[model samples]
Target: MAERKLNGGLKAALEYGPILAFFIGYLQLKDQVISIAGTDYSGFLVVTALFIPLMVLTTGLLWALTGSLSRMQLATVVLVVVFGGLSVWLQDERFFKMKPTMIYLLFAGVLGFGLMRGQSYLRSVMGETLPMRDEGWMILTKRIALFFLALAITNEVIWRSLSTDAWVNFKTFGLTAAMFAFFLSQGRLLQTYGIEKDKV
Candidate 1:
């Protein structure tokens, strides 16, 4: 799970491509609803369909190139396929919308479980990329676990209270922005914890 930095563009593409694919596919297919069993489907179905294959392809390529994929990436893809397939096949938008919540909650559970076992899953993955003291890793892990839970709650709120398109936008763009901002806000803690940005 220790990954050196990939090329910036490739990193962004690998990370964001599936989300963008969903958003774009939804937009392009908004009017092209596919009918099944005399029922017409809409953007959600198209988005889920596109998102799954794109995620699988991207993650598989990453694993092929790196010879490894983290537990998180594997779980994310699995959830995407499971929930997304349910959404598409069962014609239930809730399944698609719950994907992120499930992913975030899963991560939170993992990180929490790791912490309870006196280990840091984040550190296990990022040890090479972002060296830090054990204490730092512990604190960061707790923070991230909390953040993941918060994100899950937020996703639930947004999906339930807002429109599908709005939720899609949040998934594609808003989440990325929020994560970047949170990362930026952690600069001081990272610096204190022996972050070697220059070397990295």
Candidate 2:
């Protein structure tokens, strides 16, 4: 069966929905939570408490609507459940804060493994929209693997040293902008290597 085309905007929403939801929910509930919890409730804690289940539900709904979940999506769901559950169970918001770092590293490792196996799993996921030759796919996969590793390291640094709000902003917008810039820089190469419609 031919793969269904994903709407870019929908894809973006699905990818970032959890983070956005968490931020919005936290902001909305912050004062109420503080008042109820006797001023001892950290914003991060309030956010995580609400974020985890909401994310899981959102992801599941997306999967059902899409009719298929990509490997990346599957991995994300697993990680969110595991880490999010840990955060609630331990009553520590640190697990929630580190989720992005874990996700990036996990993707980096998966991409690296695919490269070692001479397969471009990243290409497999994106191939429909961004088709390319095998060589192009390999190069793209390697580059993205490295990019994910960098993101993981960057997340670690930000979360460990920066304030929670700073880290959240970086995760929500800064990192996304960086990824877009990186992809844009590769436009020329992608065009050169892209599979033509007739050829496809």
lDDT of 2 by residue, 68-151 (tens): 777877787778778877876676767877888899898999999999999998887888778799999998889989999999
Report, for every candidate in turn, its global Cα lDDT versus the true structure.
0.86, 0.79
Give lDDT tens digits, candidate 1, residues 1-200: 55454677886788788788777788888767787678888867866777889889999888766668888889989998999899988989899899999999999999999999999999988887788888999989999999899999999999999988789889988888878887888887888886565654
Off by over 4 Å in 1: 1-5, 36-39, 195-200
- What value does the lDDT take at residue 115 in candidate 2? 91
Q: Please report, as a residue range, the 10-residue window in candidate 2 with the lowest summed lDDT.
A: 30-39
**TM-scores, in order shown?**
0.90, 0.86
Write out the backbone clash pairs for model 1.
none
Residue-level lDDT for 13 in candidate 1: 88
Top-TM-score structure, candidate number: 1
Candidate 1, residue 79: lDDT = 94
